[model samples]
Target: MKEIVKFSFISILFILGINIVSFSQSPNESSLGIQIEKNPEFRDVELYELKITQVFKIGNQGKDSIVLKAPTTMQIQSPQLGLKIDTIIGVSRYKVAQNQLIIYFSKDKIYDFEIFYSYFGNVANLNLIGGNLGSFYYWDANEEFWYFRSTNTKINEISISYPNNFYLLESFSNSKDIISEGTNKETFISRSIQNIPLQFILLNKLKYERKRVVKSNQYLYIYLPIDSTRNLYLNKNNIVKKIESQFDKVICFFDEVTSRNIDVIQIDYNKKGRALGNQIICDSSFFYTHHLLHEFIHVYSEIRTVKNDSGYFFLEESLTEFLAICLNYNSKNRDIYFDRKIAYYSNKSHANKSIFEVDKNSNENWDLIYGKTPFIIHLLSLRLNENEIYRILKDFYIHYSKKEVTFDDFSLFLRNQSVDKEVFSEFIRLL
Candidate 1:
């Protein structure tokens, strides 16, 4: 009897130990948000899969129940898009669609799971400032709801393998020139530019001028789309030539931002001042001659960074803004773009700090990463040589591409090149 009791106790302890090892402290503990981990292997232009098990720490401040709630449905969506894959699942495993799944963990527990499928279009993150992940209610959990800034985003087609009836009927613009159609049937694709694979259609028909701006090494890349009808044309040959000239391999991607991901440029007109930087989805009412030059420099330099839907908010837009201000401000491509005002509203910290400064506190607020970072870069340009500045910027992009370069990457690049690190460091310190 004594031996049996001891054996039972040992077994219980062993099981408990296994459970503890299965999970670590949730990263979402402080914020109660989520983090998406990319799949280890690349499946063509497949975007990173969010391992739902990859624990996303929920923010403690907002609706605390985000952790406790067993969500009945999840919709990956935007205001322009009603496209979603919503299903209800609890403790049981759910093989809802072809490539997606839902598995359950214990309370305050997390694990990694995957939904694998080919992408129909783009996958973008919805930004809900001051919103907590827990605020998104799962009808089952009775959680409070929080609002998000639903800009024009890339919505993927999950049911392509399903019957054609499941897929959204695509519509295109009647006039190839009409860029936007004020919330038409299709979310991202122009209404008139219809009946074709959007990636192929966008790649083939898109044509925009390089806007005769001379490159002096340092430059900015801005994609500006005008009107609610976001149609920007690109002559395939020009695109091929320019892209081939810069990158060793060129690919036209409809969704996902890795090495060669490009999206329809969207910029704001005179009115609202919410999400800033180059609007990736909507068309800008006014086009800047220098905008092409700035964007060209990013591709030309082969700034081989893995930018996602939010990368523009995090790095690309701020860097592009900084580079554009420095290059366009001095170049002949200058034009009145009062409509495309700079507000680093998308990712605020970068708007205020050094271009490479990683946000120490993920939950902090920022409104200037777009506007202010450029001024700092411009200031740096004043002290550094245009050629040196250009080389530095290019090197920064290339070196960072080798790995994720933080603000420290800039410091490391300077040291590795044996350039006087102080030249740029002093500028950063001053800022």
Candidate 2:
């Protein structure tokens, strides 16, 4: 009996030690898992579907709950598992707002739970444009890229697979991460998808054949949109020649300040807009005239490391507008354009807010942000002389390219150049 008691006590102690080790290894840690696959059934242009799954581990030692939410515009599928807290397991409660889905769950005492949903349309992270050339998505060469991000959970790994028929065009990731098995192309990202941009391009050969490309180094390339229509504004050949010839002039204008090559995609879409980056997606009719020059200058400033802070729009948009006008205006009547803009800005009814006071929250604030402020920059240019102003812009680009800068920092930069404080101050007073 005594020997038996001693053996029993030893076994109890060993089991207790194992329990302690297990407890120590377990902590209140959470992760997010994601998988995106192309949908085959959808035939429309908006056929892509995304599956987002969020997992939360409620640490056994804690009571903090996890919240999962999505933009209200998304159509989330019903979650599979009901809420299980402690010994009690039941349905979890959630609410949907105009463009949001708010879900609450305990991550500490409840242990672990997963909530998932599917949404239609192309990935919001990718600006996808579809034409006769099929669907094209652009990735900025400069910044990091990610799909949806979680506020509280850390994304550990994301496995993304393209459509089985799609071919990989470009990928800047490690070769090991990208695997080609059978007809599908797969990439596994162990790195945090948060803000880490992927330099990649995937083409769906089943949708459209490869279009012609004019390569100007890795950064600069011109892609002609595939179109069978030789008439209307979507004329492929004429538009290509027009953009090529005009963009060549733009290259000469900012040649010294930027070596970053430009990628001009001749899209047939009827939109008259441009996104600021290494990529410029434009309608066939959009040339490298004043409109593009202005926008591209904005792009140049963006590629530079400027301190991004409030009130920097004066230096950013305004300066770009000023330069575009200066470069693209016919020498004979450039002043007419400047005077007309200044007069139009001066006549604005919403003069209650100064240019500096106009935050993004301001309603109908375009006149001040885009009009008055740029005219103010033009006014300052006149006082500082065109050469001095151009020097300031060039120097600003050289010193602060690809960096963050604020308005005060920009002001100090001008001051250091011995610009007249009174003149600069006058411009500030108007703003």
Candidate 3:
């Protein structure tokens, strides 16, 4: 009777155009019978506003009808950033959610649809930008079209049409991706990458200047605003000297040489600095050496940690900041910085929360993660000498460089290392 009931339930699900088996697979895994080809076009590109049109060709290859839930909006929130859907075509019966569109399709049927939308206000500030007039545009292709768990999606091509007066100074993209430059319009094609999102950067020839420097055999690309006063030029030289002094220290400590060229763009943004892939976006007003070194360390020791996992902030931000200060500052300055961080964390109301409980997205928990967590790492370094701690971190980086690592995986790796059991237990207890 139980087996018969289970079979009937599955039959009902199939009749309702639902695939039960696909739910168990990974979010990016191929669905049972759904395939999607996407083409996105950006036009009327300006500093603060742009229009985007995306076309999707979806096909079903199974014997049963399927319900497709396609994301129809970009997940961005800003009072100044307004997103308006201008047009939609190719589907008559569809329901719209906050950021998703749901539609029903018949078996073996192919459907082509298009969505036109407009984005306004600080659009170029999505990653980072500097100067009075925006000089660069950064786009994360994946976030625009989020993961569809029940579909095999491929980005076929992308088109960007900018103003005629602005020339394409420099463009950056993944090696597998290709950009065909044109007078006012550019075409981007992805050769083999699927599901993985690629980042693209477009620089304006008139507003930005690029400098390429080779330090210790590693290439560094510095993009700065076109300044007539030569102040930025002098600052650029100072930045190179700082990098020259810190590059060997990072390599020696990590015991790894990152072959990829690093791009540092001086930008005016709310945040002090941020590292995306191999690019460092530093705020022009607050370009301190320690802050740049922190972002630099992020590029060198980049890890593929499971997103939003427990202790994610601890591993990504806390550890990087701790290592940056260790490598950048002298003993006295390091002690002062560590003491200040300890004091700041002690005063926070959320200081009682464990590192595992801190959320990266919550602004309230920022101090706990950035302040308390680093001090905790400092404590561990004290228990086991700094050299041993660095060795463990190096091993962790080598083992999990390109793999998705979870908090438990990190904890287990640390526990398996040859450390004192009592000290390790105390450290884990503190976290």
Which structure among the candidates has the greatest TM-score? 3
- Per-residue lDDT tens digits of candidate 2, residues 52-142? 3334434443433334444333333323211211111222755544334454545444454443333333333344444345554455544
lDDT of 3 by residue, 1-431 (tens): 00101111000000111223212322222322211111133234333233334445566646333333433443322344334444446656655444454555566667555544444443332443424534444544434433222355555555556665443322233334545566666554544233244344556557667777775556677776665235754476765566556665666666655444667776555555767666776665434556777777777774776767887877777778777777777757877888988887787778888877765546787787677777787788888876787788878878887788887888889889977888878887887
Q: Score every model by TM-score.
A: 0.36, 0.59, 0.68
Count clashing residue pairs per candidate: 46, 21, 0
**Judged by lDDT, which candidate is best?**
3
C-alpha RMSD (angstroms) for model 2? 14.9
| Model 1 ranges with Cα > 4 A deviation | 1-279, 289-316, 327-367
Off by over 4 Å in 3: 1-57, 63-98, 102-106, 109-135, 139-150, 159-173, 176-202, 214-219, 228-234, 244-261, 285-287, 300-302, 330-333, 343-352, 361-363
lDDT of each: 0.31, 0.50, 0.57
Q: Which wins on TM-score, candidate 1 or candidate 3?
A: 3
Q: What is the lDDT of residue 239 in candidate 3?
A: 57
TM-score of 3: 0.68
Better of 2 and 3 by lDDT: 3
Q: Give the TM-score of candidate 2.
A: 0.59
